[model samples]
Target chain A: MENLLEVKNLCKKYIGFELKNINFSIPKGMIIGLIGENGAGKTTTIKAMLNIINKDEGEVKIFDLDLHQNEKQIKQDIAVVLDDSFLSEYLNPKSINKIMKNFYPSWDEKLYLKYLEKFNLPINKISKEFSNGMKMKLKIATALSHKPKLLILDEPTSGLDPVARNDILDIFQEFIEDGEHSILLSSHITSDLEHIADYIIFINNGEIIFKKSKDELIENFGIVRCDEKDFKSFKKNDYIKYKKNKYEYDVLVENKADFKRKYSISVIDKPTIEDIMLIYIKGEK
Target chain B: MAALKGLIIKDFQTIKSYKTTILFMIVLFTIGGFLNDDIITFIPVTMPLCFEMLAMSGFSFDNLSNSDTYIRTLPVNKKDIVKARYIYILLFTLFGSLFGLICTILVQLLKTKNIGTEILISDLSITSGAFVGIMFVQIFQIPIMYKFGAEKGRIIQLVMIIVLMLGISLATTAIMKIWGISLDNLAVMLKDYLIAVLGIMVILLYILSFVISRRIYERKEI
Candidate 1:
């Protein structure tokens, strides 16, 4: 697949937190979901890739152009939605339209107005007065109004109810329908990713733990529930990770069908994204 | 250029509420001018100072909203951001001086009903002096504000003003003791060249301030 963004060997260091060899790519016409716990470097990774923060070492290429040599040109096609940062609280949507008209050459004033009407956002009211969901919708509307090809968003679905999150997911899905646009969205809400993301990159402790297809994680990987005796009979190599309870064991299997064929365990449960993340973070190796 | 315009527009929108306060200040200044015509002399100093405060308020608002971080992600370079801020300051300073001059003219016309070239000349000198001094102070304050946020920058500005006061006074005393010239005599002697010297100094301060601000912002990991 043709890639929209490619980040390699990205690294950044703070007093206590660091991103170690962070790397990823967003293929054209696809959504790549970035998932991690709090302080897991998801935001840091996004910031570094966008050049909002200085990276200690790395190379970032967007639209097949070197970031340092072509930042302004590349950024023309890129849109960003930060979790806690935005234009300003004092600016109403109308004023924002005026300010943004000067930034992006492709800024569509009519489309922005349409987005406001469609979302029922007030052009006269400042963003500070908006509820959490409304604020998110405004951010999305602003982001899309520029007609950017690549959208890099951090925690776009957080602090949203199910209805709002679904609305946002629908937007993301629609954004990439042209088969040339792409989105990199970071959210801890795994279920949302399941709804739209084609790929998932899990970051843990400032490092990328794994990057897999959504179907691979959802369809192939599973959990085997069995008593302690059955767990004891299974070899250590049989399961990827196992968790022990008082009277039973839950083993994370790489392939449920193969595990079933090799062992007599008939209770292989299909794992959700959360189940996979929980096992990856808490289950024993 | 588009990026610079966008940044300026953003700052304007950030401080839009200050328009009412500015109007209030203008009214108060006008009232004070009517009560005492001598207030006309202070316009060049006070009006410019108020505009400076308003410009700094933009920085405070930017810090509050975390807009700088968001702007960095845009298509603007750090150098251009610094340049836009200095340009905004310059424009505000020029506007302030113009406003003060116009107010001084109108108020003098209303009160005395005759043109006073003598007082106008004196006020012009004071205006030039205050404008140069404001630029000097800004050259010092802006880089500090860019390095630290506007909140901490204000405290540092206070300390810097105190130090500058002490330094200027001591330097003045030493110059008087060495040259044995009265302050008024020295002023008249140097009056011809003061504006020229300060003009050059203002230009240099702008360059230095812009360079320092750009360096501070480029290295900043926002």
Candidate 2:
């Protein structure tokens, strides 16, 4: 399948932080979750892909069209929701509807009103009076109303209760049900990604640590806990990285089935997305 | 075209949202018209001064809402954003002129005091001066705001307006003194040729400003 979005060797440098040679691809009809610690360049990468910020080096392609050249055309079919809803506080949804209706070629008034109703957003109330969840929902409603094929959401589910988050996730699931739409969602919440993500991309500091399918990550990745003597006996290449405790060493291996076959005596346990990220970040070679 | 319309519509909605501010300006203009003949004659000048305030309000609101990032995500290009703002300045000027005209007519019909042809000429002078002043400020201010953002750009705009106003006033005084032309004669000279020159200059400045702002904003990081 053709990629809905692609970022190749993306690089952006700041005074103290850098997005270093970042790369990722989102296939059509799939949700790709970007997970990272704060200042790990997740926002930077998203901004680069969206051309919100100029990338120092690299290329971004949306629907196989070069982003910089076909920006206006490509942007028509793409929707973005930043951390801030970015709506003027004084403008109510009614006014916003009138303003935004002219912005997109495929704007669906019925869909927008439906989302507003489903989200329980007051049509006449200014955005200033909204709760954070309501603000997020408003943004989502606006994004989805335009009939975009690719949705780029930055921390959309952050700061929401589980119910709110689930509601949003369900909307995303519904969005991709047509098999023609896709989402690139960045969040710190690992469980949210675990529940809805098809592929998980982890970034640490400024670089991509790994990008793997959720099933492959869940089923194949493992943690091996053993004494120092037993840990040293295993080949150095067997595990990607390891953390040492007072009593034993915890090793992170990519493939549990192969690792277990090679060392039948060592115990292997399944690792969660959080566990994998922590071990990758906190553990050392 | 639709994207540009959307942007203009958004800014118009923003202006509408500032209900208190618009109401206050209207009341102030109406009261000024009722109390003083000079105020009625200079309504065009005074109205744009209000619009300058309106422009400032728009900038602050854009910053407050973080609309720059949001606007970029739409189908509109950076150039379109710049164009829309220029269109907005034109719309604001048109609105101000219309409001000033209505008040001038109200002052004429409702009051016993009538100044005849001299007031008409004075009104023209004031209207031309206001158009030049308002456009001058916007031409310099928009590009600066695009480059530096609303906060620092506003300071630059204030300083530039002051400097430009002072310089124009001084230049006018010096020219009149050197040429031995009375104030009325000079106003006549402006009515005949200077308004046309100023109008052309304003258009050129607006075009230049649009280009410069588009460049600044295209390169700006959200």
Candidate 3:
């Protein structure tokens, strides 16, 4: 599949934190989940890709177009939803429809109203009057109404209730069902990503820890419950990170099959995205 | 241009939401016409200054709600954002000036038997002075706001307004001394040349401010 978005050697410097040499991509017809802890440079990476924040050094290409040179054209096919609702508080959905129609050539008022109805958002109420979930829904509704080829969402589901999050995830699944649309979703909520992501890009600190297919991760990446003797039997490089508990040593390995073949152990189990993230976050490298 | 329009429309919606503040400003300036003293002189001179206050309130709302950050995510150029704000400054000043003018006319028509030519000329001068002063404030203050954001921008705005007020008076005095024009003649000169000169200056400075603001904001990390 053709890549929809690509980033290489992305670098940004702040007073206390630096986003250093980040690289990743998302293929068309795929949902790429960007998983990272707080302050892990997830939002910064997304911003750099979209040129929302200036990058010290990087090349970002969207739809095979260099981000800066073709930003407007590229943006025409792209829709973004940050955590905060960008809509002015005073504007209702109706007014927003009027305002947005002028910006996006393909803006669909019907689609917007459909999403609002689906999300149970009030059409005439000001955005500030909505609850957190409703605000997020309004942002999502706006982003989706433009018929974007790619959706770049930064922690969009953070404040949403479980039901709303599920509804949004379903919409994402439907969005990518056409095999032309793609999504780059950044979130701390791993479970949501785990449900819909085709590929997972795990970032830590300022670096990409791994970028692997979701199926590959589900089938191979795992945790092994073993004591020190059993853990020592496995080569150090076979596992990415490990933790030593009082009862047993839980080691996070890259491949369950290879470890199982080598050790012939039955304690290996599939690791959820969250489990893998926590291991990387708290475990020894 | 469409993006710029969208940004301005967003700001208009925000301005519309502040109905109470807008009403209060109208009431305050209208009440100024009731005063039978020099305070009325300051009304037209200061009414346009309130445009700065209105724009500042918009900035405050953006800052408080973090909407500026959200605006950056839109599919528009950073320069468009700056341009929209500068346009808003112009619109706000014009609207405030018009509001003040209407009030003054109402006061003149209702309270006074015959509005003398001197009073009309004085009122015209005050309004023109206010327009020029507020335009100056906007030209400098917007770029500062782009650099420092709403918090520090407020301080810079106040300081710049004071400087512009003093600068205008000083320049006027210098012109009076050098040109040997009486105060009445100076008022006529202001009435005749003020809009054309300052209007041109405002356009040039606004363009310059837009360029500077875009540079600052484009490079700024939100």
Best by DockQ: 1
Instruction: Tell me the deviation in Å of residue B14 in model 2.
Output: 1.7
lDDT of 1 by residue, A1-285 (tens): 999999999999999999999888999999999998888999999988878889999999999999988999998889999888888888889999998989899999999999999888999998889998888888889999999999999999888889878887998999999999999989898999999999999998899999999999888898988887788888888788888767777789888999998896677899988888888787897
Alpha-carbon runs more than 4 Å astray in model 1: A245-247, B179-181
Candidate 2 has a TM-score of: 0.93
TM-score of each: 0.96, 0.93, 0.92
Runs of candidate 2 exceeding 4 Å displacement: A227-229, A245-248, B113-118, B166-191
RMSD of each: 1.7, 2.5, 2.8
Model 3: per-residue Cα lDDT over B15-71, one tens digit each:
777779878877876776676655466666566677667865677777767787777
| Candidate 2, residue A165: how far the Cα is off, in Å | 0.8
TM-score of chain B of 2: 0.84
The 0-to-1 C-alpha lDDT of every candidate, in the order given, reads: 0.87, 0.87, 0.84
Provide per-model DockQ scores.
Answer: 0.78, 0.73, 0.58
Number of clashes in model 3? 0
The alpha-carbon deviation from the true structure for residue B102 of candidate 2, after best TM-score superposition, in angstroms, is: 1.3
TM-score of chain A of 3: 0.96
TM-score of chain A of each: 0.97, 0.95, 0.96
Q: Which CAPRI quality tier does the interface of model 3 achieve?
A: medium
